[model samples]
Target chain A: MTAVLTTTAMPPAATAPTALRRALPLLAAPVAFFVAFFAVPMVVVLSSSLAAGGAPSLANYARVLLDQYHWDVLAVTFRIAALTTLAVTLLGYPLAYYLVRVVSSNALRRSCVILLLLPLFTSNIVRSFGWMILLGRNGLVNDTLVGIGLLERPVRFLGTEMGIVIGLVYILLPFIVLAVGNALATVDPTLEEASADLGASPFTTFWTVTFPLCLPGLIAGVIMVFTLAASAYVTPALLSGGKITVFPMLIFQQYSTVFDVHYGGALSITLLVFTLVLVALAGRIGNGGGDRS
Target chain B: MIARVVLRIVAWAVMAYLILPLVVIVGASLTATSYLAFPPQGLTLAWYGRMLADTSYVAAFGTSTALALAATAGAVLLALPAALAIARHDFPGKRTLLSLLMSPLVLPHVVLGAALLQYCAALGLMRSFAALLVGHVVIVTPFVLRSVLPQLTPEQRALEEASADLGAGPFETFLLVVLPQIRGGLTSGAIFAFISSWINVELSIFNTTAELTTIPVKLFNYVQYTIDPVIAAVSSITIAVAAVTIVLLDLTVGLHVLSNRR
Candidate 1:
């Protein structure tokens, strides 16, 4: 996930009294730039979401919250996101474990990491386009399934939730792998060794020792994946093929085609608030587990 | 041992899944057919040639490259100072300020794009190069800051002090000692920043005019209506660029990020 970009290392404990004055000048430009470009735009969106006819009102929110159609869209959006998260974690944890614990050759591990990042570095459009080709009625996926007699006919994946899930999982798998792989790498083998020496079976050792230690990273990765999957615009847009819609698609439609800033603002804020709330809850749960362990 | 076997199989299968789409795009690009084909009816680079002949594709590529370059430079300039300050000094709202700077990483780009469009329109900056550049810089600056902050360790601070004690000025100490120590991080962060800006679509889509669109956005509009070899060729170009960048990064900075030694 791009959150990898913001993951902090240790900050210095404290600084000299004079260091604050020296640092103030350095902080000024970036802070001012962010306030101007980043913070203010978000404020604009928030204000628009609340404004109706020049006064702050919840009319737009009522429109969004009252409509059954919007509810259906939100359901579909979160369904795909939850399913994507589940699938990616299932598929990603094993890969991360293999890369971190099983692969002994450093060169091979490096190669695997590169392969993991290649798709990530590519645009979402290109990646979803690849699926657009493969998940077509006559695409490779259906061809292989039919060839092997698993299906009597070509299955339609395009415009289906399954197609969207496949693409989202593909797009997001690397984030979980990186997050879990880093966590797995940091687990001391001696702890597991001690577990085995204490007569715990392999399964028990993994469940009680290894997995808990890496739970924080796993939770972080899940949050990143779920937030991204829920709010994703490009993948769902390209893969949904117009027969399906997600929440971000609704926001995009309002902003791009309808140019309904007020309504669009409400929709955007709705998605943002829900995502942040879910993330905060997840963070709390994760922290609680970490503290317990 | 049996469990290990199953894990290996699943892991390898997932790896193949990860590589399959990229291979398909590259393979489809080389097809001689007018339409896309997998094992490519026949091998030909004609689509790539056609893409090159189209000046719009060329222009979009040029615009995307220039935008990414400018954004990378801007992020480095803005983030390096911020990283130094956050690492070297404690001020009021330091944690609040740090989160504010990094908030773009988690915020939805679609919302950000829409917000920028609305906000920039108020300021008369919408749908221009500057608007696109600012949005790109905002999103990518966190990459530089994240990578650079860790390099400003207490050990490095000790080195900086030593340089100052040797009668070096602040600029001289930064240039001679601090800069050399953080060079690896700076390069890695800059590369990440460049790539993020280059491959961005959602944010750039709002601020891009027909004439000033990025490659991803161009391919996006074209792909929604059509699936041709030319689009594949264009996508293949971006994938190739990604591969080259990764190889370059691995060779230069050693992208062994999963190491336990940290």
Candidate 2:
């Protein structure tokens, strides 16, 4: 398949000099675009964060580090993100596995894929607004809980961590399913079959053979979910009912209301560094898992 | 058999979880009640009518549509050339450059928004449409790059070479041969970029004024203080737009991404 595809209409292999020359012009547009907009804006933020009172200072970082409010918000953000990631992986992996390994009908699988993607394509406000209605006092969720005798009164879901978690999980689940499903689809069934033929139980065959192959996808999906959930602003803001505060909310307030660019830049940099560190750590784990496989 | 039944049940439940919020928003928007309600109190389209009557909502919608369209166009222009370079050539810092372009996908929009606000303020561009456009373009360009790059295979490169060898200039070859092959990727990428820009609140929130706002940002502001059918109406419109876009996407590019992999 690879060889046939490669030969179909392959581009002439240009000489080194010509390839470099042709590529240089093409690179100019995107390179200049990113440098002007992305890289420059980020540099601006970092510089502002580092400079205070006309000199570089640790005051901004010190403010972020020394403040209990910042720590509390960061903790809440990380806790919600971790929980969301765990829930998505726990729920997504089974659905992905069932779709890939169990489902026989192509039509059904296709429909399932569409259903998974629908939420992803929808606006965050629209999705969170739906939850707002459902989690409201007269919302279906509260009504259902009451109807089922689970609660005597409608619990306040709009202003709680649980509400944010539900919203985050809804938005992030599709990433996990798609990632895991792609991995599951590519696993060599022969490997699992051989394990079974060697007198291993079905469960044992899955654990010993199938799961290892899909670990990289699982890790990638988890990392994506965690990073996104941690950085999420709209969902948390909309669902939190002004009672819950997260890191992004602080950044928004600084920029939008306070106009404290120096402080805001520091907060933004803090979140960026934290998210990047976690992403790097997750990549390391994914790479380690891939090596073992 | 038990395991199969359990798996089916779980899959169905997950699907319901995905659809529930959208259904609720649409239902609430049609409610005759002034306040938002679920099983909606006496179905009516008054909220939608009210939404139309509000000029701010209308203006916000117009601004969002224009912004998203402009951003998506800019992204396509920037990304197409970049994808060609990355796919067809090797260069120093190529991997780093690609990562820098794509990092916006995972970078917190609040941070980007704050950065842009600070940067633009220094340049006397803050809180203007231009400021919003530049930031939106920065974030959405990566989506276009990602979708277009994978479609530019060596095979496609060969076709472009063939076009060039047939006395076609680079621009002519790109238009006649290269563009048609990657049309699917471009269209899908543009759709994704457009929607991402349209639904954006974190990035748009910084630069948006009371007079200049996107729908999502407007909704976010209103949603904090009030829960009403008008908000529901606005949310419902966005939901409908999303449904339409997804259907169009499904028709054009086939949204079923994972089913045929095996």
Per-model root-mean-square deviation over C-alphas: 4.2, 3.8
Q: Pick the lDDT winner.
A: 1
Q: What is the per-residue lDDT of model 2 for residues B131-208, given as tens digits with 9 covering 90 to 100?
A: 999999999999899889989996887777677667776566767888899999999999999989998988998898
Docking class of 1: medium
lDDT of 1 at B212: 90
In candidate 1, the residue pairs with backbone N, CA or C atoms under 3 Å apart (3 or more residues apart, or in different chains) clash, namely none
C-alpha positional error of residue A192 in candidate 1 after TM-score superposition, expressed in Å: 1.8
Report DockQ per prediction, comma-separated.
Answer: 0.57, 0.51
Segments in model 2 whose C-alpha atoms lie over 4 Å from true places: A1-20, A188-199
Q: What is the per-residue lDDT of model 1 for residues A1-293, given as tens digits with 9 covering 90 to 100? A: 12211111213553455445556678889989999999999889989989999998999999999999999999999999999999999999999999998899888999999999999899999999999999999999999999999999998999999999999999999999999999998999999999999999988998899999999899989999999999899999999899999999889889888988999999999999999998899899989988887
Please, what are the lDDT tens digits per residue for candidate 1 over residues B120-238?
Answer: 99999989999999999999999999899999997998888777668776776678998999999999999999999999999999989899999999999999999999999999999
lDDT at position B167, candidate 1: 73
- Candidate 1: regions farther than 4 A off: A1-20
For model 2 the TM-score comes to 0.94
